[model samples]
Target: MSLALDLAPSASVEVRNVDLAYTRKARGTAPLSRFAVQADGAALASVPDEMEVRSSHLVRFSPTGKPATLQTYSVETLRKVEISTSGDTFIGSTDDDLYVFKDNKKSRFLSDRRANYTDIALSESGSRFGTVFCDMLAAHHTVALGDQTGRTLWTKDLPFAASAVAVSRDGSVIAVGGEDGDLWLLDNARNTVLKHRQEAAMEAVAVAGTNRVVFASGGGAGVINAEGQLLWFTEIVGETVALGTDSVARTVAVLARTDTNAGRLILLSGENGLPVWEIDYEDSRPTGLSVSANGEFVGVSLRDGTVCVYKLFYGDRLAAADGEAVLAEARAARSGDGSLLQAVALLQARLGSVPSDFRACDLLKETLTDAKEQALALSANAEEIGDFLSA
Candidate 1:
């Protein structure tokens, strides 16, 4: 006897595989000391030169996984090491010193009285950097901004302890999130712009563009505008481990752990905190997460002493098909129908992955111009405008 099985439509939908572009093993068993992505999409990682000593060596890897430069540091522990887009490096260490390494020279910039710096953030241009200091003895935390030369620009004391800090790409805004659920947005002049209270202690914080800030806490993650308004919040299944953002693309990548201790990466829109996609990894625990400047790639460092890079546009094959369908629907509809505008947006999103679509770009430009003209005409008509406003 033979049996027949029925399958759902979703089963027939092609499942695109995400490419594990590259993997590099850490130097020793201690895992990666720290890792950051450069502005040009290169990755920098630090690993112990020796298994028993506190000394470490920093390694630079190209986007294609080729090892580039390697530098040795005598510092004991490099807590928060960040590299600017321009190849400048800023690092805070257990020795209570902040150092700036540029042009093959290392200079000690600031000596903190605190135990160690909890986090460090660098501006896109590497002109400015910010750090969060954890002074356990004084029972207070401080957020300090500094220039490229490692000179302290300004410092702000917080009532609660902060572990996460971030500066906007333009170096115009600074954000600090504390363990006591305090969130502060400050201007470059050290003036407070907005302050809010979060439900849980913050684990990560990032600035997206000029007006949006994203943060992850024990409860989950959320996004806020520059005006201090809560845009949206999403609850995760477990601990929020790390957060990374692409300011240019307005995309946020979050690393969290499931209840079973599996690692998962979630991508969200920076504007609305809406979920875009997610990937799960059961074999390794994520220690660090970073997205490229253009949001085209994501790199994850695992506790097993391996770094993995994945492409963001691997699912574009499916998206292009959906875009074609939307365009067909728009063409079949009436000229003034809203489907045309929807088609334009769909095409725009697909263009992120398929930038060579000249036909779609031309159609989008024309549709946007038509929509703008229609809007202007409606506003010029008094009766039509009044009716639209009332509705």
Candidate 2:
């Protein structure tokens, strides 16, 4: 699990299910909501009176959105933060600089020649790091490779600014996703190995193996071999909202329309790009998604600042056993003549595994909307799942 990458912007977290499927163990909004931004540069929330404009730091929030104890830094706004697999070193980025934290000491520098860093990545070994620099005046984007001590290794200009970047486990390969819908594979020396182009931007890229690359885009998810041939492509209808942060068992990705919150979380084999299973989570607008390296957990963060995590169960019979188990529990809950509160608790339990059936998702929505006619809106049911959707 040496690979780490960043997702698009949105508010914080809520749910804290650590069961056998998707699991963020929580998600809560950060006191510093500037991390959640609109692509159009709209206002989100104001900074606290005690915090200074230059006093930048990364705050850890429990799934409930309350601040947890963590270290702090001075890179204003702290755009994106990633740590090595060892969890000893960390890399944080800003619009113009990159910060490296190790051994309880920190160092900062403007990486490479370009500025306006939009995205950041760190290798699993914590030996290497990279940045996506956007030169707005020149109308182009650049990628920079560097070492852990705040040193720039090399910079490669891109046809367009990159939307995301990922580093391989061994720290030898780098994947860059461009706004122009191109995926570039670069070696340690910055040589281009493969360039896969598409009509949509790449939301994420992973080094599945030596020439095996996994990518998620607006169209769908797929894999390619060293020769750059399309190994397999799963056609998705709209934009890819988030991708599972899978470095070992690359198994899941999220898809949804840009204009709506309806989304599909697809678990694929990662071998042939065939669908293993899919779940519908209309819980909230998914801003981020990823599966644990062991393939046992999946996490989805919604736009309302709620982070929902699920623990997964595996099976050889991928067709129905996995999904059937979910619906079975839902049915059992209803057959027991369970109260709506119990259903909401079960709803929180199956947050990400609500079956591929849209009816279950519709039920959550319809039940939440009936708040006008019933007290359910202000009940724990709302606090459970309804709270996120209201945002």
Highest-scoring model, TM-score: 1
Candidate 1 residue runs with Cα over 4 Å from true position: 1-18, 28-35, 38-41, 50-55, 112-116, 134-136, 259-261, 314-391
Highest-lDDT candidate: 1
**Predictions in order: lDDT:** 0.67, 0.57
- Candidate 2 structure quality by residue, lDDT tens digits, 26-132: 33332111112111111121122244555433334233344443444444556556655444567777677778877657887563355677777777567888777
TM-score of each: 0.69, 0.62
Model 1 lowest lDDT segment of ten: 1-10
Residue-level lDDT for 11 in candidate 2: 16
